[model samples]
Target: MPYTLIKSSNPEDFVLVHRFLMQAIQRLRAAGIPLWEPEDVSVDALVKAYGTHSLYLVMDNEKTIGGVFVLEEDALFWPEIVTNDSFFFHKLVIGDDFITKGIGHRVLDALVELAKSHGKHWLRCDCHGDRPRLRNFYESFGFYFIDRKTVEGFDAARYEYPCL
Candidate 1:
């Protein structure tokens, strides 16, 4: 089945989306891969994202299974050249129960199309440089590795997909 992408700004969907994120965080922590900080997965932070960014929930049938945050500008990480032409996506997490189900590719493809429709030249994202599996996953999805850098004590690997 195809995945559904819902922007998490509606009050009716906020609770369900928040619960999905919480579940994803718990699973990630249990797997010993500490990607998100505790506060990053909190309901308050997610709600804040809804206000400042485009937060999306990936739904399988009628169930929420994953989410991501997208924005046009991210001065905190991307250099000026990239930030000027890219739609940046962050906090992309697929729920543990849905792993290996190919949901990520569908969601990412949709995001790329969204970027293209918005006239963006690139779809960009960042991940912890320490996680090879995560990096490989992005690479497998055709994201070109741009660079790896440490910012504010966090090591990150930047990737970009040309939205052509």
Candidate 2:
């Protein structure tokens, strides 16, 4: 399946993205995956992030299947790496209907390409430290486990993929 990631500045897109995130949060909670909280994702917060981050809507041809945010710098999660040599991925939410269809893997591949196009050396992201399945998912995508850290009251497992 071909996925198109469009950098959207539209307010409607923000709402759609927020909806997708909240849906994923609910699914995760039901599955006992303590990842994202409702407060962690809101339309207002996403709107604020739009000014500083690249918010993308993942499209599967005509349908919007997911969304993600790309940040040039993520000092809060990765304070030790004080450099813009990487693209930080956040809020990668795929619709429930699209899960397990290899859409997430394809999205990661697209993100890695996007990072390489921007001359970034690596693509980085963090997930709940205790989610082994999620961590394994990233690891399966060629992302190496960096370290686990408690940042801003969230315990996160950082991972980085070489954009070579």
Candidate 3:
């Protein structure tokens, strides 16, 4: 299947993004993953994401199958890392039906190119530290495990990919 990557800005696309995230949230909770709280899935958070970050959505035809945020400044969650030199990514959510289909990997590959085009040296992100599966997934993409720390009440494992 052919997938298109789009920068979500219009109200309809924003609504799709919110719905996609809510579906991911439900799937995560059902799988016993404490990756996000109820507050994180709200439309308010979606609006905040739109205001603060560059939101990209992967679409198969008209449906949004996945999305992620490319944030320039992330001192709130990753205070230790200098934000000036790196591109930060968050909420790489893939719809439940689209899991294990290499869509996330493709999205990430595009993100790496996005970082490179912007002259960023590193691509960084954080995930629930205790989820080995999630950690390994990042490692599989050539992202090195940097460190683990508690951020905003969650134990997060940081990963960085050198975009050289």
Candidate 4:
């Protein structure tokens, strides 16, 4: 389905984003995706995400299918990995029923487009390094896996997508 890319302006938007993430986690469990196991994504954390970063909501006409938070270079939580001044994708996923429904890709592609239009040469994101499926997902879209780095026991993958 076609989706509209929207920037969420406040913590209230995270209430909707959190619901989508909860659904995504459920779907990942049902699908047996191991690294998708996130025990508690508290509203406080979600609210923090909204306050510190740029939240992009993926909507298909009338529904909020998914969302991802992007923080520009120099924002907090950005480890100095690849030094090209790139955008970052944090908390990226879709609702449970929305998974396998092609919504996540739509939002990501939109972010890539946004980056390229702004003359950004790279788009970077990190995730659980144990998730090879997610690695493949990012790779298929041209995001190259740079390395496996750990922060607080969560193995993280540093992915870089070069602009075309």
Instruction: Point to the candidate with the largest lDDT.
Output: 2
Candidate 1 ranges beyond 4 A from true positions: 49-53, 82-84
After superposing candidate 2, which stretches have Cα over 4 Å from the reference? 49-53
> Model 3, residue 152: what's the lDDT?
66
- For 22-126, candidate 3 gives per-residue lDDT tens digits of 787788788987657667756677667546337778777887787777887688667877647788988888777777656667778878887888899999998
Question: Model-by-model lDDT, in order?
Answer: 0.78, 0.85, 0.78, 0.72
Clashes of 4: 1
Write the residue-wise lDDT of candidate 2 on 1-164 in tens digits: 66878887676887788888988888888987776667667877766754534888888898888999998888788777887789998889998877765778999988988899899999999998988888999999999999999988888999999997
Steric clash pairs (candidate 1): none
For model 3, the stretches where C-alpha displacement exceeds 4 angstroms are 1-4, 49-53, 61-63
- Give the winner by TM-score: 2
- CA RMSD, predictions in order: 2.3, 1.6, 2.2, 2.8
- Cα lDDT of candidate 2 equals 0.85
- Give one digit per residue, the lDDT tens place, for model 1 in 85-136: 7788887777767777577788888888778888899999989999998899
Candidate 3 — what's its lDDT? 0.78
What are the models' TM-scores? 0.84, 0.92, 0.86, 0.82
**Candidate 4 ranges with C-alpha deviation above 4 Å:** 35-40, 49-53, 74-78, 81-84
